[model samples]
Target: MEIIILIAVGMLASLCGAIAGLGGGFIMVPILALMYVIPVSDISGTSMAVLFVSAISSTIAYAGQKRIDYRSGLTFAVAMIPGSILGAWTTGVIENRVFFVSLGIFLVLMAISINFKPKKSRDGFLKPNVSRSLLDASGQRHEYSFNMTFAAVVAFFVGFLSSLFGIGGGSVMVPTMILFLAFPPHIATATSMFSILLSAFVGTVSHAVLGHVMWDKFIWLAIGALAGGQIGARVASKIPAIAVVRVLSVCLLIAAVRLMFKG
Candidate 1:
């Protein structure tokens, strides 16, 4: 019964996550804690497996629509790998209460950033000016001119948080890409998901090596998430962009509050 409940929860989380491009770990982790009393040490490992499966499933749907920007995605993925490894390595040593508190703060800030309307870009923002250019996986020359040093620093932080909290880092990565890097929301979502896949995969491996993964539970969760993700991706195309963004922000804010209270 417990396993069944988790699978159901995974399905629901994946559906919302697919539409928002969030990978659903934000939703899954808390619920798992409240209902199953799963240990924090194991949550990241299990969630990473679920995230990996859901991402692959969602990507298949996005691919059909040509919504993925492979170039930007690949570049970000390359940079996130080492960062994720470092993060996973550090997870066991971190205090759980401190981790949750920090994550709460980060999520709240992200929510506020997402809700803010900027006037310069269509999404009401401007990309930061920095100078790093490279060919994306799609063979397009993309430039990242927003203080490479700062971006790397931020990426490292994001990666660390993701490992600590069992999230995919999309909550952090998407906003960073949009507000700081000036990526369009859709492109940012796609790119962030790609980077998350890499980060989650590496993080999971690290956790597994540490004997933190619960394979039986994770497999069932993955199965449900994959199916739900397909449905959510299909629905995403129908939702208005602003509506989606607003809804996503609200959800993130709620989750942040919950995490803070837990802390």
Candidate 2:
């Protein structure tokens, strides 16, 4: 029954991740603590493992649909490396109460960021220094520009938070890309998942070396997450941009409230 519950939770997390590029760690970490009574170290490790599996599954679908921005995603991934290492190192020293409270507040901020709708680029709301245009599977054109420097700074922080908490940084990346960098919602979600693959891999390895991961539980959860990720990618492809943001914001807000009380 416990295994069954993990699988169900993994699927739900993956689905949420695929839609919003959150990697579902935000959902799984809290659930593992509240329901399964897993230790913080093990929970973070397990969540990272599941996130890697889900990222692969979702990235494949997004890639096929041509939704991923390889250049920008690669840049973000490169910038995140140092922070990922630092975060992994710091994770062991952090107290659970502190971690929970910080994560809760961060999630609330992310929820607000996602819900914020900016004006047109010409209105000077967005930095127009860098220009990019992507054609999705449906041949629809999405265009935007962003400040690379701002993105690098944001990516570094995202990497640190993701490694420390095992939340896969998708929650941070998607909103930052859209709100801060002026990326299209769908492109931001896809690119966020694409970039997270590397961070998740590094974080997973770091946790494994510390003996924080449960290999037995990881296998079943991974299997469920892969399937869910594929389904979510498909659903996201069909949804409106505003609908996706709504889903992202609502989920983050609920998760934030729950984590705040848990702390």
Candidate 3:
């Protein structure tokens, strides 16, 4: 049955999303469209709703791991809220082809950035103004820095991307954090999920208000995504930090290609 398929897809997508901090909306949107679950106009709305549920589940698990950067997450969340609402309002009005292509280009660039580290921090790479030192559940210590002004600016747009693409913006946020903000993969993934939870909530509500969410379908997806999220957080915790970035880079490239074609 379609419900069964939805559950399966939600679980698989959420598992991948949680591991990569993508939040699964991008994966779900394309498939849901193919299934004719709803009109394309409403697809993003539905995806955002499901994404919020998945994020909630994953954020809780990541929190337990003590991997999330709460200060950075809150700063990003505050900036992203407005963009989430605005993106929902403009969803059906934008040109899908152009947006998709632009996002694809951006992802490709991020992937390249990840594969090739700058020769040195002085090689014209961004350096953060504020520093943080965190000890995760594993008792491994991580020290990182970020520019608050820059992160706020990026998060505002990240909120728009989350709602606009229904991808939770983690596809973009994780790489930015790791590459630019000096966040370790574990911390980046966890922090990205935390920020995404807040953005997804705003985006979901905006879409629901516009009557874009299909509650009947959302229920099944939620059930599956919820379980998958917990599993993914566990899996990610076991992977080495370098491996996580490698996996994230691969995922970004994959999502970029699919999104371009979907557009």
Per-residue alpha-carbon lDDT of model 2 for 1-263, expressed as tens digits? 98898889899999988988788887888887787666677887888888989999999999999999999999898888777777777775777677777778987887886676664641112455667878888989988877887898889999888888787798778877877788888888999998898778887888888887889989988988999899999999999988888888877876677667767
For residues 198-220, write the lDDT of model 1, one tens digit per residue: 77788788878977788988888
lDDT of each: 0.71, 0.83, 0.85
RMSD of each: 4.0, 1.8, 1.8
* Minimal lDDT window, size 10, model 2: 119-128
Residue-level lDDT for 99 in candidate 3: 88
Question: What number of backbone clashes does candidate 3 have, counting pairs of residues 3 or more apart or in separate chains?
Answer: 0
Q: Model 3 — which ten-residue stretch has the worst lDDT?
A: 118-127
| lDDT per residue (tens digit) for residues 1-263 in model 3 | 98999998789778889998889876888788788845665888888998999999999999999999999999999999999999999887888888888898899899888867552342112556788889988889988667878888888999998897687789878888777777778888999999999989999999999898889988999888999899998999999877888888888888888788887
The runs of at least 3 residues in candidate 1 whose Cα sits more than 4 Å from the true structure, single-residue gaps closed, are 119-152
Residue 187, candidate 1: how far off, in angstroms? Answer: 1.8
Using all chains and alpha carbons, the TM-scores for the candidates as numbered come to: 0.85, 0.94, 0.95
